[model samples]
Target chain A: MSENNNYTFVIKPKRTLWEIDLKEIWRYRDLLFLLVKRDFISVYKQTILGPVWFFIQPLLITITFTIIFGQVAKISTGGAPEILFYLTGITFWNYFSSCLTSTSNTFVSNASVFGKVYFPRLIVPLSVIISNLMKLGIQLLLLLMVWVYYIINSDAVHPQIELLLMPFYLLVFALMGLGFGLIFSALTTKYRDLTFLIAFGVQLLMYASAVIFPASVVPADKQWILFLNPLVSLMEAIKYSFLGQGIFSWFYLAYSTIFTAIILVIGVLVFNKVEKGFIDTV
Target chain B: MGNIVIKAENISKQYRLGTIGTKTLANDFKRWLYTMQGKEDPFLKIGDTNDRSQKGSSEYVWALKDINFDIEQGEVIGIIGKNGAGKSTLLKILSRVTAPTTGQITVNGRMASLLEVGTGFHPELSGRENVFLNGAIMGMTKTEIRKKFDEIVDFSGVERYIDTPVKRYSSGMYVRLAFAVAAHLEPEILIVDEVLAVGDAEFQKKCLGKMKDVSGQGRTVLFVSHNMGAIQSLCSRSIYLKHGTIQQTGETDKIINYYLSHELKTEDELNLKVNKDIPACVTQVRLLNGEDQKTKAYLSGETLRFAFNIDCQAQGNYQLGIGIASALDVNIFSEVSELMELNNGTFEIDYQNIQVKLAPGNYALTFNLLYNGKSIQYCEKVINFEVLEINRMGETYSLSKGAGFLITQGKFTIN
Candidate 1:
């Protein structure tokens, strides 16, 4: 009990937009882990299938996507098989959408705890990102199994050397989702109308980012439209590296990087500004 | 007391009264634009006092108004206030749960608040897991929790239920487990609200003893409760708050007595308001003397009179009841009109000369309307009257509080 050290904290009504103390966040890292643990464990605990439900969601979605877009609409998958193509896209898209939605609603759902106790409010959104990563890991394993089966059975698809960039690509993607989430969640505290819009907005964003269709399928004249969407390049890059079936360009990737970096800065700034006063509004 | 651990200077918090959010984004964007232009928040200038009873002219109100105080290390300071007095808001700002709208607070050491017991406890989680989770939420690391896990379990006395899910535990066990986790956290300052009110009398005493031990170790504590006796016994100093501002701060006993005697007042009649669902209600309750007229104060040894009016839409048997409470909101005695032979649709009744051997202080009256033993409406502390000091027992004010709240007759025989 006597071992703890002193901390000199001056609490005020207002602070700079970037007055984040990374050291305090570091101190509360254990809380972050426990919260992430709670998120993942609680979601699946009561269900009989438990974590197996994680694999089933994307798998079913992929099957439906393949039937509608692949067989019925006959959308070109850039010469790769339809199932593998849709699975990879859904895997990454699932991480981003789930991360963004959870982060955006952080203030609303955790209002009860926020009202009663004080913690680094950012920990909630950060843990949501981390927890969704666990589901992504499980989904990635499912994708790897399907990828492995195709590799042994056929020579139509080959893996690219850039496949090694999978983890880095996912991190950047997660950060962008987190950034957008922080902005929306903070804003939603005062104006709750955004909560309804986000659910619809994320779905609309999936179509714009080429989640089910490849950038190559869009004609060259219309290609600028795909490039304008920052996430299209990320989606193309991930698929190009994994299945060797999507468009590739460093210029667009750099453009996506800048787009993500800007949103993240805005996200952190907005999050910091909102945390102090959101309790009253919420 | 040692060096000062917490210093709050000119603290104030403004809150929007009815609605927090702007109805549309345009109104919101204009406000944000005004903020970015370095202009004063035009909206903040518009609001009334945060009194909920009266509908104010504007949407904004100041919940806390220029609160200033300094707390010394090892001092257990009691914060006493009526409801809507801003005690909770002040504690919230001190614990950093919410920032004040103005002013600054400097804290010299790490602080933890038990604003609510079992705050983040998950129903599905085991008691042990909840302890760890709750400890981590307080900023204690895994190693710190490990060092005190056994002791916390022992103190909670829930070792038998440690492995079981908290949802299965009795409400008593749940509160004990939650409090044990908070009590074990070794922050330099601890802030507690009325969390002990949930516990039974024995547990409340144990909580007070533990708080005493915490203060004994030189930890600053800010305790808030409506219980005057608890505040007097536990705190070194006391602060009285009314309408979002401090009314007084001084020695615990003096402040407690001042707070009780000052808030308590003389009254003879109470007009109770009815809520939506209650069909039967007590609209008027009056205290009287033996002459069947309204009287303000009662002599210490006098038998009190109660006259009340019960308005019921239906003519079924209705029970009009009166409850007597101390200044601290402790219920002392209660009686129903049904027992007093007031039956049926008779809207008004008078009952006289009930034995009330009470000490000299203000006591609150609560009126109730019950139909067939079911309570339809209850108004607590609607009106209070003073019992003038006659020095019947020949004891000082301090001695009277220690002996008991009431002055009853008892025959003593020495063997």
Candidate 2:
């Protein structure tokens, strides 16, 4: 009995501020995959269109932006076809928006399951991000097909070496979305007023994220204000890489990465502190 | 003895009472500031015990307080308490569903809690999918679930609907499948909280048997239930909780007996103070032992005595009745005195040495007075008392509810 020096775990009143417990999340990796599968299958179970609905949403939104902003408003697509430009922006923005919105509802949406059992609470938000990434994969295939058509006939479209950095752009979007979502999820458990604000906030953030209009269209004087969003540079970078015709600054990309890193750290810390006792408050 | 698998020290949980949202952020800010300054939470100073019936004066109340216990491996410990006694809270903390406000718990080995069944069962997902999903949520890996898939299905008895979405299945089938997945969860330490209260009696028995098997396999279990019979049948040791604190902890029988007699608020004497001016009234009723001493509890199949004082201003062909009723409000049995004439005076009536031969449970005593079958001065549920599980022979005889209260000695003949 004296050899029981190393207990499996010790539960305490307070954990260190930086203790995120990544290994615990790794242990619950199966649950994360199951939840992601649930999210994917449950949503389109009864629908006739099914997975096709995933394409319809981004395509419809892209067309709407093309007509309303590209054609009617005569907004320049930065030398790329209006459809290709808006579709690229929407595909990436959809991933981040859905990730942010869904992940932000982590505590409120999963209170029932979380209240009854114990798992790494981080798994819920992480699963949301992964599932949204899958959705983005499907939508990106749609964007690639459109790019192929434009590349065959149009001379304005340019595929460059920067296009290889697509993964980096996606990494920034996921981290930023997850970070903000975690902070909001933790706060919303107690002050549910944040739930209503999230819906309205996500919509307003899209207009500022350069999803509809190209970053070049923004006056240079106020372009610095737009870059502060951290998403603006990533959006421009994605368009510049695919079409080879928009602003893609390595410095701004680094800025967004650093910003995402800091937010992710703070977000995880807040979430860890709240997840322990949110059951009582929620 | 095996090594201690779980050790809790001074574990307490405090919850804010009333409307939590009103000024909740301000309270959080205040608590944060206090902690930043290296001081105690100012709000924690003033709070009441977790008694849900009375309105508390302070906004914060300690749902659990200073709970300390240790469980060695392979020990099945039952937590017995009334509603609002923090049994659920303690289980929640142990399960890691929630953290305690003060103090710490050291746990060695994998722990799983059945605080509820079908916790993450998706309605749109098919039963097979839900089995894997729910299993994973309970801390089983995909491979582990796959290994136990056939056994889980066979145990649930819902093999026909395994491919069907759970939302379309009947409520019973849903519960059965849910409990089936939960049963297959083989964690080193199990925390269960009244999950057997669901499903039918047969299903509850199956769950109990499964739990017994788990405990028999040398795994520690912490069980919380209001059913004393189930607790007695499964747990070797028990902890009795009352008002967020441990009242007693020891052998299951002793803790259960203490909980029934003391915590249940049994009454040995009842003062009706019936008006002396009434035609016939029961003024006082007292339960007595064989020695004519006041007692609130009795063993099964024991002789019981009762003494009552009656004030009758006018009586003609009057009848006196004593009725015993179970906790479920069912009338178990009744005995009545023969019709007789009585003059106006205060008289003492003693129904002594009556064979109880009753089952173990809480029961109420009903007294009645009637004149010429008019049913005058009838009182119901005057006093409540408990019958211990011990029988006349001093052997522990476990009696379940609805097993028939009257114990009989039937003559046996064999060919």
Q: Which regions of candidate 1 are displaced past 4 Å?
A: A1-6, B21-27, B270-293, B299-325, B329-358, B365-383, B390-415
Q: What would the per-residue lDDT of candidate 1 be over residues B133-229, giving only the tens digit for each residue? A: 8889887898899899999999999999998989899989998998888888888899989865666888888888888898899888999998876
Q: Residues B80-179, candidate 2: write the lDDT tens digits.
A: 8889999988998998888999999989888899999999999999999999999999999999999999999999999999999999999999999999
**How good is the docking of model 2, by CAPRI class?**
medium
What tens digits encode model 2's per-residue C-alpha lDDT throughout A143-252? 99999999998998998899999898998999999999999999999889999999999999999998888888888998888899899999999988899977889888
Index of the highest-TM-score prediction = 1
**Model 1 residue B368 lDDT score:** 75
For this target, which candidate reaches the highest DockQ against the unseen true structure?
2
Q: What lDDT does model 2 reach?
A: 0.88
DockQ (model 1, Cα): 0.49
Pairs clashing within candidate 1: none
Error of 2 at A225 (Å): 2.0
| TM-score for all models, in order of appearance | 0.87, 0.84
What is the lDDT, from 0 to 100, of the residue B166 in candidate 2? 95
